[model samples]
Target: MLEAANLTKKYKGLTAVDSYSLRVLPGRIHGLIGPNGAGKTTVFNMLTSLVEPTEGRVLFRGEPITGKRPDRIAKLGLARTFQNIRLFKELTVLDNILVAAQIHKQYGFFSAMLGLPSYTREEKALHHNAIRLLEEVGLAGLAHHKARSLSYGNQRKLEIARALALAPKLLLLDEPAAGMNPNESMELMGMIRSIRDRYDLSILVIEHDIPFVMQLCEHIQVLNYGQLIAEGNPEEVRSNPEVIKAYLGRSAEHA
Candidate 1:
């Protein structure tokens, strides 16, 4: 459902993301893994049009969306969550989702000035949809609570809920399990799988947690030094020599 061809991103003398390409098929979870500074986030930025690719193109289905405005890409059914949580801290969980749903309603001066029947109906429907989304992500009890009041894991769930409010065909998630404990991460894995099947979503996930990605994704791509070095199913990627080397090098550094 999504494809990137020969994508590259550079900043002056440093090449952040070098000629990389990948495909995400409908209803499957695709994993992107790499050590720090391997340009994983840069790829996310390029695909979502947050940062213009220095070279190459991104195609949603068959049309080129490279360099399109972020809002335009979002309207075309692409949505993403950041590695670090990016919620409106002061807004209630329900309100955060409602704000996203309201973006889909058709509005004009007449609709606002006269309070047309269609406007009222749309508003009510959005509220219902937002409530449904909150329930789906297991945040119904916290619906009226400030976003900042939720625990870390619930915050991540809320972020996913907000993204799902966009009704995206392809969802890009960056490190959904970044700060979670083992139990939370395992629960997150289940949630991701459930949502993917329930919503018929195509997902491209960039995560550093190896075991989590191995168990949750159908395919994995490994990146190192700003380039894709390996791509395969879990076993193939896990046993690959280069992937082993990358992890081993990092382990040695920590030791």
Candidate 2:
């Protein structure tokens, strides 16, 4: 569903990402992993157009989307959640989702301001869609509750629901397992798999959770020092000498 070709990002004296490329097939889950400075996030930023790549282009379903604005890319069926949970903290869970659902809504200012029939119709549809996403994310019961009132796990789920509100064909999850307990991460694993099939969308996940990524992704790509180092399935990546050496070196450095 998505193809990144020769993606590179250079910041004056620093080359954050260099000559990286990967393919995300339709309806498949692809994973990216690397040690801390491997430019995993940089690659994601380029894909989503958060930051322009110095060189390289991204194609979504064979259409070039390189250098597109984030909002434009979003409207073109690409959506993502950050490594940090971002939500409308004060808004109700349903409201938070409603905000994202509006991306596809065509209710013009005049129609909404005048409460025209068209606006009303669009709103009803949005509400229905929001509720349905809530149910799918297992947050139906808490739709009316303030987002801040939910526990951490539920907050994470709420963010995911908000992203789903965009009706994206490609969902980029950045560190979905970050800051979650074992139980929560395990639940997220199941949720990711379920959504891939349920929504019929491709997913590209960047995660530090090795086991989770391995089990969740059908294909994997590894990065090191902002460059492509390895790419394969879970077992193949796990057994790769460079990947092993990188992790072991990281462990030793921390020790």
Candidate 3:
């Protein structure tokens, strides 16, 4: 559902991302993996329109979406979560999700001042939907709790919940398991699978946890030194000599 062609990004003397091309099919979890500085996050930023690519194009459902503003891309059914958690610390979990849902509504100053029937109905529906989303992510019980009060794992799930409030066709998740313990990460893996199936989503996940990616994603793409070094199924990617030598490396010290 999403295709990137020869996508490249550079910053002055450094080429952060090389000409990389990949496709994400509907209802599949595609994994993007690399060592630090492989430019995986740069690729995510370019794809999500947060950073303009130095060269190449990004197409969503066959239409060019490169160079669009982040909000515009979001309105076109692409949503993302950051590598680090981004949430309103003071807002309640439910309120955080409600804020995201408001993007889909037609709210204006006059509508709010006059309390128009349409605006009221939309607001009510947004609340219900936000609660539902929170419930889906296992945070409904903590809806009224401040975002900062949640545990680290719950915070990650809340981030996902907030992203789902945008109703995206394609979801870009950067390191969903980044700071989680083993149990939390394993729970996240199950949640990812469940949500992917439940929403019929096309997901692109950039994760440093190799075993998690291998076990969860249908296909894996490997990058090293800002280049697409390997792209294949888990087994093929795991056994690839170049991938092993470049990414995993030969010696135990390298791993």
Candidate 4:
């Protein structure tokens, strides 16, 4: 559903991502893994056009989206979460989701201001969808709580749930398991897989949790020094000599 071809990003004399390329197929999960400073997040930025690529292009469902405005890309059914948890800390958890879910509203400002029937209908729908998403992410009971009041792991889940409010066809998750424990990560894997099947969308996740990515993704890509060193299934990548040397050993604590 998403294809990034020969993506490269350079900041001054340093190359962050060098000729990186990968594809995410419909209804499947893909993983991008690398050690620190390997430019995995750079690839995500280039793909979503948050940072313009120095070279190469990104295609979503066969159409070129390289250099498009991030909001425009999002409107086309692509959504992503950041490596660091980002939330409307002051807003209620339900409001945070409603903010994203309302992006699909069909009514105009004047309609909303005037409280037209169209605005009312769409607003009602958005509210229902927002609550449903909260339930899916196991945050239903905290719907009215401020985002900042949630625990670290719960904040992560809230971010993912907010992304889902976009109704994206493809989701890019950067380190969704960053602060979770083993059992929590395991539960996250199940949630991610279930969401993929339930929503019928593709997912590309960047994570340091080796076991988490290995078991969750059907395909994996490894990067080191801004270049892809290996791309394969879990066992194939786990046994790769270069991948082991460049990243596996460093990430063994998570294994």
**CA lDDT of every candidate:** 0.91, 0.90, 0.92, 0.92
Per residue, candidate 1 scores C-alpha lDDT tens digits across 1-255 of 999999999899799999999888988999999999899999999999999999999999888999899988888899999999999989999999987776577877699789999888888888899888888889999999999999999999999999998889999999999999999999999988988988999999999999999999999999999999899999999888888888786442343
Q: Each prediction's Cα RMSD?
A: 2.4, 2.5, 1.9, 2.6
List residue ranges in candidate 3 displaced over 4 A: 251-255
- lDDT digits (tens) for residues 22-125 of candidate 4: 88989989999999988999999999999999999999999999989998888899999999888999999999999988777889989999999999999999
Residue-wise lDDT of candidate 2 within 174-248, one digit each (tens)?
998888899889999999899989999899999998888998998999998998878898999988887887778
Candidate 3, 1-255: lDDT as tens digits: 999999998889799999999999999999999999899999999999899999999999888999988988888889999999999989999999988887788878799889999889889999999988988989999999999999988999999999999999999999999989988889899999998999989999999999999999999999998999899999999988878887656843464
Q: Which ten residues in a row have the lowest lDDT in candidate 2?
A: 246-255
Scored by lDDT, model 2 comes in at 0.90
lDDT for 83 (candidate 3): 94
Cα deviation of 36, candidate 2, in Å: 1.2
- For this target, which candidate reaches the highest TM-score against the unseen true structure? 4
Give me candidate 1's TM-score against the actual structure.
0.96
Model 1 worst lDDT window (10 residues): 246-255
